[model samples]
Target: MMSGGNLSQYLAKSIAVMVFGSNDYINNYLLPSIYSSSYNYSPPDFANLLLNRYARQILALHSVGLRKFVVAGIGPLGCIPNQLATGQAPPGRCVDYVNQMLGTFNEGLRSLVNLLNGNHPGAIFVYGNTYGIFGDILNNPATYGKKILHFLN
Candidate 1:
């Protein structure tokens, strides 16, 4: 049987994994015809807005006794199947524009990881390089024992 303090300590040791930002871009920001975000803010501004909220959310978790975190950044949105299906890219390429916008968000996420670790004592925040890892896999699929399949229109 664990006491209240012991239970809290045990819970704190459990790492929390957080991933966000993809749906915001693909479902909201990119759909200017359906959303006003594109008109209200540029890509960089949108990314900043997301990071501000993200920082707060993470802090809220920290305040609740979560001391270990694994925060993953948004991956290459342009390379995803849904984006690729839009037929914006050339025969065998990704939508660079979407990827670039996501890059801004991912970069800010990296900074957020550093900021959280430095500002909060006794708390550890690790940044998952999801963007880099996904990009590498997309760029060199063969190296990872798989090949990207391209479709014909």
Candidate 2:
């Protein structure tokens, strides 16, 4: 058995940084041909499903002494080159429908941070607004300087 000193040291180093869920949308939800997620659950419902699972997983980690978490929200999947290739969006434009759906998921993830922090005293949970950060970079390219590249056919 670990003494309090060793336990505290281990917990201090057990920071968990989780950034994911893009595949759930890009690989599953958007692929109606191969996956039934879109037909089976509405966007909000899907977000709830993911959030519920996320809460359980984080709680499991907390039960094991993980006290710090940095959860990054899903970014703009609509702007992916693969999604752009689908032609559902206009040339050089993102699939707003897909982004909007993921936006619902991101919002829930933000709430999850608050919920976890409120319920677990002394546990630290941070919500990284990657969506907002990425969105700003996409929306105002000039603010960070600009570059354009052409793809070969």
The clash count for each model shown is 0, 0
Tens digit per residue, CA lDDT, model 1, 1-153: 988799789869889999888889989998899999999999999999999999989988888789999999998888788888988998678889998888788889999999888998899999999989988876676887766663322
> Positional deviation of 133 in candidate 2, in angstroms?
0.9
Model 2 — which ten-residue stretch has the worst lDDT? 144-153
Off by over 4 Å in 2: 1-8, 145-153
The whole-model lDDT of each prediction reads 0.87, 0.85
lDDT of 1: 0.87
User: Who wins the TM-score comparison?
Assistant: 1
Residue-level lDDT tens digits of model 2 in 1-153:
999789977987788998768888889989999999999999999888888888888888888788999999999888878788898987767889988998778999998999888999989999999889888878776677665242211
Extract clashing residue pairs from model 1. Answer: none
Report how far off residue 68 is in candidate 2 (Å).
Answer: 0.8
Number of the predicted model whose lDDT against the real structure is largest: 1
